[model samples]
Target chain A: MTSDATPALDPAVADRLKRDGNGLVAAIIQQHDTREVLMLGWMDDEALRRTLTEGRVTFWSRSRGEYWRKGDTSGNVQHVKGVALDCDGDALLVQVDQVGAACHTGSRTCFDGRDLPIVTDQSVTTDGDPAALEGDARG
Target chain B: MTSDATPALDPAVADRLKRDGNGLVAAIIQQHDTREVLMLGWMDDEALRRTLTEGRVTFWSRSRGEYWRKGDTSGNVQHVKGVALDCDGDALLVQVDQVGAACHTGSRTCFDGRDLPIVTDQSVTTDGDPAALEGDARG
Candidate 1:
């Protein structure tokens, strides 16, 4: 299905987008596995449509008014895991599996050099293993 | 000198923030090493001051209008690397050295479990190896 599938964006959602200038919301996509942000882009009905259909991340290009696939050329594709809406629904939080570095620059993650520590097993386990106290998280 | 330097917010900066609301801006903190997103929070003059002063991540709670120090209770602290302002100077991109999980739920990163692959060379490497940082970053 395409954005056309939805017929039209919900009026309430459209109203908020109107305040932002048009029927567009900013979507911030992040690498789900690494928690690294891949990219930030705009989304309209059509872009949102392609994202759902293609299984990859797509965005509406405001400057060109065209659909942008995340890795169309760079190969740093973003695979969509889930898309979430902010309380206002005017913004989107896109969770994705990033193929590689998301930025045009040669960085591991779009947030390269941020220098954050790996917190995979802090409280759950002191020795790289999840403790029984934490139980088995389905995740 | 560190994340805890409490400098008076620049007057011009404060004025700009006040014009919009107060000396408050949204800080998008991303993990430096993994490039993962940790969290999104607001920053007022005081929070900004604390972040700069403490050399740790700090944000103003829009809901509470108070300071929020990352990892204060959870040990998922974000060590400040750098701060960038958008053209409007109303938003901040904070690059940090995040310790442990940025999210309260204790995932490796706030973004977890998306599935996209950036095709790369045949030789697979470990997760944090510098050589495999980006797909085409072979050296």
Candidate 2:
């Protein structure tokens, strides 16, 4: 739970993010040890700057139009371990030491709860591979 | 594989995605069976529509500013099996039966070949329990 500035991020690397149109890029949060993805958030220049300068994960809330640091309200803080820029530079893989539940609904991930329903439309009907379409497309 | 117009996605579900700022949402691609995150792409309304209608994953390329379908040129096609909308409606979890390497570098995922460098900053130092930091932030 180190809160000092300078986590596992390279300032030069963060600058390479493509934040052109909306001054934002998608930050994918993953659990440091398990590599399980917790959640995704949008980060602006200031948000990335703060995240690098301040260790704790900070995100640009689109709905609120403000900078919200993780764990400011909930104890679910994400202490960054390392930050990796995707080859495309448009997305980010943020490896973090997460604490508590990552989802606001008390789930471990934002992807839980909802089961992806299979569409019986042409796309699925065309594929007769019954084995590949399990567990929300698990094969 | 079913290359016809149908894929494993529901159009109505995609319609629920919120496309306010920049008219785009972060589309996170995940491997159907392996659960490995392949890549992240941006999807506008048109992109989402095409993905649902056509069955192949289509993304809005920010740099090129065009609708690019997966595997169109690279041969790395993401045959979508399922699509999930985040509770906030700002992000998407796209499960796909991917073909070939998802990354341009011939890697299975865009996050490969990088070790998450650890930082001795306050964030890591505050938490002394190494046991709790297992399972990608799991105790």
Cα lDDT tens digits for candidate 1, A65-116: 7888867898878776555444434456676778766766766544333321
Cα-based lDDT for every prediction: 0.55, 0.69
Share of real interface contacts recovered by each model? 0.03, 0.22
Superposed by TM-score, candidate 1 places the C-alpha of residue A14 at a distance from the truth, in angstroms, of: 13
In terms of DockQ, the best-performing candidate is 2
Supply the global lDDT for candidate 2: 0.69
Residue B53 error, candidate 2, Å: 4.9
lDDT of 2 by residue, B8-43 (tens): 335566656677567788888988777777889988
User: How high a TM-score does candidate 2 get?
Assistant: 0.73
Q: Report the interface RMSD that candidate 2 achieves against the true structure, in angstroms.
A: 5.0
Q: Model 2's A-chain: what TM-score?
A: 0.75
Which candidate number has the best lDDT? 2
Q: TM-score chain B for all models.
A: 0.66, 0.74
Candidate 1, TM-score vs. the true structure?
Answer: 0.48
Question: Each predicted complex: what DockQ?
Answer: 0.06, 0.28
Candidate 2 C-alpha lDDT tens digits along A33-105: 6766778998887776566545678899978899997787898888866565677677777777888999998
**Alpha-carbon interface RMSD of model 1?**
12.8
